[model samples]
Target: MITASRVFLIVMGLGFIVLGLNGLLNPLGHLAPYGLDYQAPGWMGEIRANYGGMHIGIGVLTALGAVHYAWRRNALALQLVFLGGLAVGRTLSVFLDGMPPTFALVFIAIEWVGAGLALWFLRSSN
Candidate 1:
């Protein structure tokens, strides 16, 4: 019986997978309404062209990891790296380069809270 928390995490993870893939896959225009500067990074021009698949994969794994956390809490550790990475990336985005108010802030907050919860869930097995 998956509780509300599990469902929330699953859905949240699934959302990221879809959003990230869309941004990476559809580079013709702004995939995120708030806008993502894929070119902000070093060698972005070289990377962005071929990075959509990676984003999609991350998104898929994020949702799967959340489910793994819900069903098998121990597996949350596997995703900790990703959650931590996301937090760092967003922090860098906000600090080094300017980010829009809408999606960027939301992503940062989600990454922070999600990472914290993932850590807590992994620590306690009750």
Candidate 2:
């Protein structure tokens, strides 16, 4: 039986895999969103492309990695830190962009809770 922690990790990992693939496959549209900023550096477009691909690639790899790190109980520290970082980024985005209440709340819900769950699992595993 999957423990509660394992369940959370699996769900979050799957979500990351899906979102990352979507971004990776649709580079210009979904992945390269930051490249469109006027304030972006001259090399930002290239950076954006590379970073987006890398992020997506990492996400995909992590999704697979989570099976061991998260689900099967290995590398919990690294996974915790990664998830914490993601949550922080997402939290910061809400403030910087100032999204609508519902949307912002939804993002907040995902970030804080999802990341919290992952972190909790990591901590408990130790």
Candidate 3:
């Protein structure tokens, strides 16, 4: 039962889990390179809650989708929305705000690819 979908779910889930944990444990170190810094104490809490908690939840749910048959489609849908949303937002920023950092450009490409894969798997499974 080691389908590509399962592998993708596991990989993406684990990746998000790691990222979430990093964001939680070291928000500044994790995001400071991206020009995001804590302007106030509340900023740390915000990043820890939104980026850390939300991503951890996403990761757990995604990994669950891999192991639970009933969750597969829903999990794929989650990937589509999450990755697609990021791509859309970033793309919009490029048009409205002009070019961003090279890293952001790279992230946009990766998010699109990930969203495409999620969509492909979602459709193929139907």
Top TM-score hit: 3
> For residues 1-126, could you state the per-residue lDDT of candidate 1 as single tens digits?
875446545765676566556556565344445454455555354344344555556556655655665544533553566667889898987778886587668877887887777777666646
Per-candidate Cα lDDT values, in order, are 0.61, 0.56, 0.91
Candidate 2, run of 10 with poorest lDDT: 31-40
What are the runs in model 1 whose C-alpha is more than 4 Å off?
31-51, 65-75, 97-100
After TM-score superposition, what is the CA distance of residue 115 in candidate 1 from its true location, in Å? 0.8
Q: Give me the displacement of residue 88 in model 3, in angstroms.
A: 0.2
What lDDT tens digits, residue by residue, belong to model 2 across residues 1-126? 656765665565566656665544554555243444333455445544554565565455545644664434442344456666766776787789766456446756776666566667667767
Which of the two, 1 or 2, has more lDDT?
A: 1
Regions of candidate 2 where Cα sits further than 4 Å from its true position: 31-52, 69-79, 93-97, 100-105
Candidate 1: how many backbone clashes?
A: 1
lDDT of 1: 0.61
**TM-score list, all predictions:** 0.62, 0.60, 0.94
lDDT of 3: 0.91
lDDT rank order: 3, 1, 2
Q: What is the lDDT, from 0 to 100, of the residue 89 in candidate 2?
A: 78
Q: Candidate 1: minimum summed lDDT over ten consecutive residues — where?
A: 42-51
